[model samples]
Target: MTTSTYHGIYAVVSRIPRGKVATYGQVALLANLPGRARLVGYALSALTDPSVPCHRVINAKGEISRRNGGSEADEVQRHRLEVEGVFFDSHGRIPLELFRWRLYADE
Candidate 1:
């Protein structure tokens, strides 16, 4: 992806408030890059900024997308979310309706 594209994704990710999460597709849509959810993931994977809060981005299923057997990173993401007061159900899935950040047209 172009640097501008990744920057757009980063901007959207940065807007995700603490204690809430957004799906990759949601980030793509908000970045005006609809239908490029996977691109959001790719951009996040390449993120080097510690302030971006990439952990707030998850899959559509409200679960962390596996990263080439990187279970440790998965744990870290979960831990961060929990610290922010996001919870996972017994199935290890977040209830998106409750924790997903919503951006209304006015906002």
Candidate 2:
């Protein structure tokens, strides 16, 4: 993807508030790149800026998607989310209904 595409992804990701999560698809849509969920994930995986809060983005299933770095990355993402008051069930799935960010026009 172009740097512009990645920047667009980052811009949307930066808006995900603490204690809430957004799906990859949601971020793509918000970034005006609909149907580009995988691209969103790819862009996030390529992130180097600590301010992006890439950990706040999850799968539509509300599960932390395994990265190229494997379980360690997943664990880190989960820990960060948990610290933000987002919990997962025995199935390792977050309750999206409760924790998924409902973006408002003001945000």
Candidate 3:
């Protein structure tokens, strides 16, 4: 992805509010790069900005996707989400139906 695409993904990730989550696909769509969910994940994984809050992006199933680097990254993401008061189900999923951001409808 180009630097612009990476920044676009990060920009969308940064907007995810606390206590809510958005799927990678949602972020991609909102960023105007439909079908780029994996690209979104890639950009988020490369983020160095402490305030980006990339952990707020989950999978379609509301489960944290495997990070680019492996388990350590995934663990860190999960911990960050938990710290933000986002609850996980018994199966370790976030339950998108409950926590997924409804965008304009929510605002």
Clashes of 2: 0
Backbone clash pairs for candidate 2 read none
Q: Give stretches of model 1 more than 4 Å off.
A: 105-107
lDDT of 1 at 44: 90
- Candidate 1 backbone collisions, by pair: none
lDDT of 2: 0.90
lDDT of each: 0.91, 0.90, 0.84
Tens-place lDDT digits, model 2, residues 42-104: 888788999889999999999989966455978988999999999899999999998989987
Query: Model 3: per-residue lDDT, tens digit, 1-107?
Result: 46988888888877888878999999999999999898887787677888887778888998988844566878887888888888898999997877888887563
Decide which is better by lDDT, 1 or 3: 1
TM-score, every prediction? 0.94, 0.93, 0.87
RMSD of each: 1.7, 1.6, 1.8
What's the CA error at residue 50 for candidate 2, in Å? 1.0
How high is the lDDT of residue 92 in model 3? 94
